[model samples]
Target: MINNRYDFIMLFDVENGNPNGDPDAGNTPRIDAESGYGYITDVCLKRKIRNYVELVKEGEKGYRILIKADRALNSKFDEAYEAENLKKGQKGKNTDDVNKAREYMCKNYFDVRAFGAVMSTGDNPCGIVRGPVQINFSRSISPINIQDVTITRQARTTGDRMETGSTEMGKKSIIPYALYRAEGYVSAALANKVTDLSEGDLELLWTAIINMFEEDHSAARGKMCMRKLIVFKHDNVLGNCPSHILFDKIKVKEVSAPPRCFSDYSITIDADLPSGVELIEKI
Candidate 1:
């Protein structure tokens, strides 16, 4: 098995406003100060949702692969998996579920992808140009390799007189742990290649990593519109991944510009998301 560490990072921004807070709370979600209703039609909302789903799917897979690799490194787990009486698919699902939870926690804690939109309250909301929300996602898997690690075991077998051979023939010998290490190398290199990335090379990279979490199309859409994003160490696929190993250690950036200025803009949407997801108006 290929034993190598995989590190990846993705970053980008998208437009925000509308759907950020409780619109009924005397506060209208405005972009640049233009209250009332945002131009994002229902069609647009659907489109965004679809995009998010695709991104989540892709991100989740990448996360799963990493988790699997980690499990393979555990001698006890690997032994149980390679045991003669074990089933064919022992470690796959268990590892995947655990990784899924982990990814979800990270996304929620870091707010890697913006969900609802936030609007400006002051004056001239529609006057200021709101920039995209930046997102960054990073991951690193080290010591990934297949090695011949030894494990010691005590003898537990007895032989019958009929088994005429060496005295140690039927007896169990103290054998060392010897198994093939299936170290997994999953980063943007493998993630993006399998994913259908949509805008902002940086955003696309982040979306790909988000796919390592839950299957939420909205997250991907958010990345496209400069709203939500994903960041990682580097782009191993095209050598764009980041050089840092502590991606999770970084902080997620918030929108610093005005909201109203972030008017409707065209963005490349990933075609893999749900079908009916279209851009929508905030009503």
Candidate 2:
């Protein structure tokens, strides 16, 4: 079981692509309208992490993804109840059976152990689990610019358009370049007491974060990469210092205006750290 708490800062960048698009705004890159800072949702990052875990740990025991695509969540919940040999609980109430199913999920699913889940939607009714790991939304350091690029297809879809030699025109949203930072936390208390997140699981979480974007390349996400992963591990289960204080110790500044690459910015870390805390750079 995990015995120490951890806080981490992730730095990633996107070039010539949309890191995340807002479907409501015609799939434009998500941004803070007021500040013009680019945004990538926590859910979006989590999905990439989940995909990485699922890919690397395929068919491995205790590494199943709970919220996978094309899989029914209620069916998984039912499987948990059936596997535990417990009867389904009534609506709005958690029983010992429900607790058993919840434990089953925590034991079998990596995401459940790391990120937790609410399994009360179905008749099986597994109780909610407060995961040991949590991540915040990523925000760019500086204001970003979004561009709409137009492209044309050689062949037309419709017969009439084909006969007229018409081409299909499409628009793609992109950010010329941007660097984003996201903060994440790992709770040892929750890990030991709640989800039983193990040391191996913790290590796997780090690996997943470091490689979340490696296999997730696409035309839309253009050239995304994990630039830096700075971790602060406390000596004990309860952290030695506040997360904000540790976060403030690291500084990211744009050395050049209209930055288009990672080297255009400078990142500085304060070597003098608080007691009972150790900083590890996992890039």
- Number of the top TM-score candidate: 2
Candidate 2, residue 203: the lDDT equals 89
TM-score of each model, paired residue for residue: 0.19, 0.97
Error of 2 at 247 (Å): 0.4
Q: What's the distance in Å from true for residue 227, model 1?
A: 12
lDDT of 2 by residue, 111-186 (tens): 9999999888877778899998999999999999999999988877789888867777888989999999999999
Residue runs of model 2 more than 4 Å from their true location after superposition: 92-94
List the candidate 1 regions with Cα displacement exceeding 4 Å.
17-207, 210-283
How far does residue 20 in candidate 1 sit from its true spot (Å)? 9.2
lDDT of 1 at 56: 50
Give the whole-model CA lDDT for all candidates, comma-separated: 0.27, 0.92
In angstroms, the error of model 2 at 181 is: 0.4
Can you write out model 1's per-residue Cα lDDT over 1-283, one digit (the tens) per residue?
Answer: 1111133223222222122222453332212233322222222332333355444544543221211223322332233233323333333434443334323322221122222111111211111111122222111111111122233334435566335543332221111111110111233332232222213333443443344223332421222222323222222243332233233332332232222222222223233322222222111
Residue 6 miss distance in model 1 (angstroms) = 1.4
